[model samples]
Target: MSGRIAHLADVRGGYALEADAVVVGSGAGGAMAAANLARAGMDVVVVEAGPQVRPDDMTRDGPAFLSKYYWEGGLRMLLGSGAYPTMSGRCLGGSTVVNSAIFFRLPDWVRQAWIDEAGLSGLAGPELDAAYDRIFTRLKVAPTPMHVMGRKNLVTRDVLDRVGVPNKPLPRAVDGCIGSGDCLTGCRQGAKQSVDRSVLPEAVDHGARVMTCSQVERILFEDGRAVGVEGDVVDLDGWQKVGRFSVRAPRVFLAAGALHTPVLMQRSGVRLGGRVGGTFAAHISGLALGILPDDVRPWEGATQGWGGFSPEVQGLKFEALWGPTALIAAEWGGLGRDLSQMLQDVRRAAMVVMVYRAKTKGSVRATRSGMPDARLWIPPEEIHVVARQVHKLTAAFLDMGAEYVFTGVKGLPDRIRTIDEASGLLSNRLRGRHMTMTANHVFCSCPMDARADHGVVDPEGRVHGVPGLWISDASVFPSPSAVNPQATVMALSDLISRRAADLSLLDA
Candidate 1:
């Protein structure tokens, strides 16, 4: 249970903690496992590769920390068979700290869908619900108060009402949220109770040790069993060293997120049908932008308010999102002096919940032995549906008095000067440019029963060949739930951690 705060300059002669388990990636999944295992009196060591962002280190506005914490500078393009972007965070608490803090338990239908489609009976309705309740109680989640909806949520609510779309308040994990609305930037007020404030601290309290800035380069295996991990100490920036150290854990849990977990397994010489980085999705997300007349204060309210989907609504779904002044300014499309003018009006912008059913049309292939090359491209046919929903949603916003609309201005190839000109260039109107997007959720790569020929992990997130290695993150999400995935990930992870702890038999 004793370990040091891992930094870029740290090293070890052998397994320092030398205990029962080693958890790679101190995100939602790993933290949950560590908490359960440590509480059970198992010696647990949690390793992370990013700097620990403290309250003072927290910048209370914009997605300023986005570039700092996110992989690929928050511009990760998940090239579906069509093209788009999907970015994520890479800090100590990982993406959990940088997320919108909205916690939606897997809806009833999602669990049923997994059971019916992917054959994961273990994560069915009642059991999943019980797990959700446990994690929810542990995390102290609550709804975003109406009074704190801020200007953006208020305007979006009116817009949805006018369009006959129901907008509900979202539940978040924070306690005393005052609508600073910079959830993507990293919450500084200690208000957003992300994993750092919740599970990780709990794990630490239960005698778990966290090593920050320690980048795990690869999983080390001996005689086909996971013995430990190796990599280097990373600094504030995301850089790793060469010579690696090893730990000896009979149990190794890979929670390095969706993108890296598969790669890590592959590097460790474990091949479960070789579907390491395949079966990826990004919610095929598109942004909703509106140029309002009033000062909406982009940096107000919860970063993500609330949203739901409707078969009635076509390809896209609804979710309210608020941005900061800098991001709003960045989203403004134009050239030269005119762009400066739009940037000045950053206060008058509010965006809507927007996503079409993203396609599972890409793969994260190993670019080399230790690196991966993303082979993502969205489908062309889906763009019509994506654009249609966006157009309809924009109409609803315009009905609510939005003067100008810029659906994906940040993805636009060129800049538009006037609101009058924006109408001509919103949808298929895009430059056919493949932009990078990011979601905290990861799935399908290790699908339970895509058939053994292609799946990496089984329904229970256990590796097909490895004896004790298991995946409890979004990597095993058969298909994404239609909501922020924290609740689902935590619930699923909680379920798995309990199974790992039960130990009736270890090698499932």
Candidate 2:
């Protein structure tokens, strides 16, 4: 019934089809691992839950957005005592294809923290520096050019400077960006260099076979060793399939990212050191928007960031960002005429960013639909603090010429902007109640450490409980990265894949 062909009768029937290794997920981690292994002459088969969304086919705006970039067509949410809807990509390249390509290798502070506290080995200065260099060069990490700085970034920079925030241009994974600002809508120009166009292609070039629309339900073991895996191939959605298949490899790399990988292990009851999905978290993030008067062309240049982190006082980092005109217009939900005027002036929108210090009050639960659902608790106290911080930043933006200020409605400390008539807009526009929550940055699900008691996988990402089973993704982060996770994921996978290959050779 879905776009891909599958059979149910033959389900639960796959008997480890032969491959040198099976790499689960084709995002930054799996792609890099698969490519590296294949380059080492190993036959690597990559399994992806979402359908293959080629770089050539993506558009800035289309019906494809629901089915392509978003999980369950953007219907996923993070619910709990304090709930928030979170959207993530489900396509072949996973979230990497759809994320704002703010490239950041793990900062030295965080890397050292993992080594000292988390027991992860081999990521000291020179070691991590080389990996970082390789991954950044591959992704073409660079700052949003001055010409590409939209009004939002410009205004935010000016405002932040006035407030002594001292922001800088952020690095991103785009090539030949024409400042079309379609990075979120799918980079209409040849800007964003997601894994679909970068590492995955490299893997394919290195004799790796990537099978999209393939979901691995369970791993098949022979005796005490990992022999292969069995599962069904369904459409991108986790609908029932007609036929089934099994992929077999002596080694299996679980790189399904932070959310789904542990769910896969838990569903199979393959408890690895009893540490799967136990400690999951991500850097808490939110959005701040500013409305301007002149036409700023919201759809021009990179959509995510031009300005980067400023010195933080409350464990927060602020960047510059813009949304699709549709999202902006929707956020400008006014009663009648003012709404129309704002929508007409979509080009005049300026934006800023918010990042939070994450704590482990988060979790991922598998739903009946075979999808992993997330839940977050943003307390009223947290809201109050964040709101005050945002309000101050908004005042700064207004100081640098902003007509309107936008932060969520939950904790409105005060309305400080032009046109007291627009007092209600902040609460309305910045409400977490809106259907615009997202979760592109994922980390700290299956961690690596010196001991199995502390982490699920070893330093090389090999499962401590099961031999030949490994993890390589944001999931293996002992702690979350304050910045983007792409560079970190790639470098870790590169290290793990190389080591795994060496182990396989020795065993052979």
Candidate 3:
């Protein structure tokens, strides 16, 4: 609370900072690592690519938030068979600042898979448990109470109950949520405990300095060991470079998320072998709208309050979703009177989404100018499975007394009045071309594996061949987590920071 948070917007001329360690991000991973290192009596400097916008300055205006906090002004696209827009946070707190405050730990199966298949040791025992405990205590992870769940989440609970599926309240990293249904756009009430308000502040209190609007373009290595980083200080509006800055440290940590970390490494001339940017995976999702009998005001509740898994699909999860009126109107698929009518009845609209544990693989490459180019491929079999799962969800919504349902598929009718018709529509012709696929949970681009050819980092999160360089973000995930990964990323960062602290002590 008493340390430095330098805003480059007010800064002029070139600058330099010396620290024991330089952290290249300030999100879930970087903030946690910086806090731990500072607590271990190391001088830490955290360089963030985005501006530091306080919670009181946040708003419910979706477009304004996207333009200010989202990567590439919310226009980042992935290319392959089809083009898909990817959302990632570009702020002092990184993706955690703009994400739904869901806090899911690493699933048991995912933990076991990493241990067995990825050769990740010490991932399941008391070591990992202590890490989780520390992070959970810091973030105040808990479930949303029923009183704040609003009517929309209650409808989802009812549908799941009618269909004989079990559901529970989602755990969120919030303290005093008012259920404004604007978690995706950042919490305006300061109730959601993102890292910017939690660990990053703690890091500052412990003598860590945070540099906002400082983008690290490349890592500086000497004799095959990381020594520091260099980049430009950009303005908050256009992110245009205004001045050059540098940081010199004994160690460097990169927690720049899965999409951009590999690109940063490639631009820095670090060869992470063939697997640096390969093996990208995500939980592809589809959405459906249910026209309720009354005005439930879906946007009044917790953004995503309750969720459950179906017995039909092995790794599929269903959850209630709500968005802004403008976003909902765009998805309604009508014009003129029809669109106006739908917007007028928006209060009666509730949404349900299905997330499939996709088996597809993708890659991210660094361009000559240091930007990332992502290519994702969804297999035909996986597309069919998703289509079937979405059909089942739509049928359930229609059976639960909803007047009608709208599947967001392009070739399908705007609305389905009967369960049989929905089934036939999806079963007969649902392909990748018809459905729009987007993902928020991306992983395994720079995984941690014992095999040098398969991973970029070791189990301890140290970059394989680069001493004093470490990675402590979602990029270290050996595979898709099949759930929200903020908690997992934080826990792993705790472990990595502990290791880095010990190494720093020896060097001292």
For each candidate, the alpha-carbon lDDT, in order, equals 0.67, 0.68, 0.82
Q: Flag regions of model 3 displaced more than 4 Å.
A: 424-429, 503-508
Residue 321 C-alpha lDDT in model 3: 81
TM-score of each: 0.89, 0.87, 0.95
- Model 1 lDDT tens row, 377-477: 55655555555566566677666666677665335323223434445334564433533233445555555553556566676567777776878787777
Q: Which candidate wins on lDDT?
A: 3
User: Model 2, 408-436: lDDT tens per residue?
Assistant: 45434222365343344334234334322
Tens digit of per-residue lDDT, candidate 3, span 1-508: 3568888755445589899999999999999899989988899999998988777657767777788888887778777756677788999899888887888877787789999988886786677777877777778888888878999898888877766667888888998999998888888888888999988988898899899888889999899899999998878666578988899998899999988888888888886666788667777878778887788898898998998877766667778888666656655746876777787567888887877777878998898777788887888677788777667667777877778888877766778878776764455555566677567788788999987777899988999988999999999998888778899999889888988787331121
Alpha carbon deviation, residue 97, candidate 1 (Å): 0.5
lDDT for model 1, please.
0.67
TM-score of 1: 0.89
CA lDDT of 365 in candidate 3? Answer: 86
Q: Give the range of the ten consecutive residues with the poorest summed lDDT in model 3.
A: 499-508
- lDDT, ranked from best to worst: 3, 2, 1
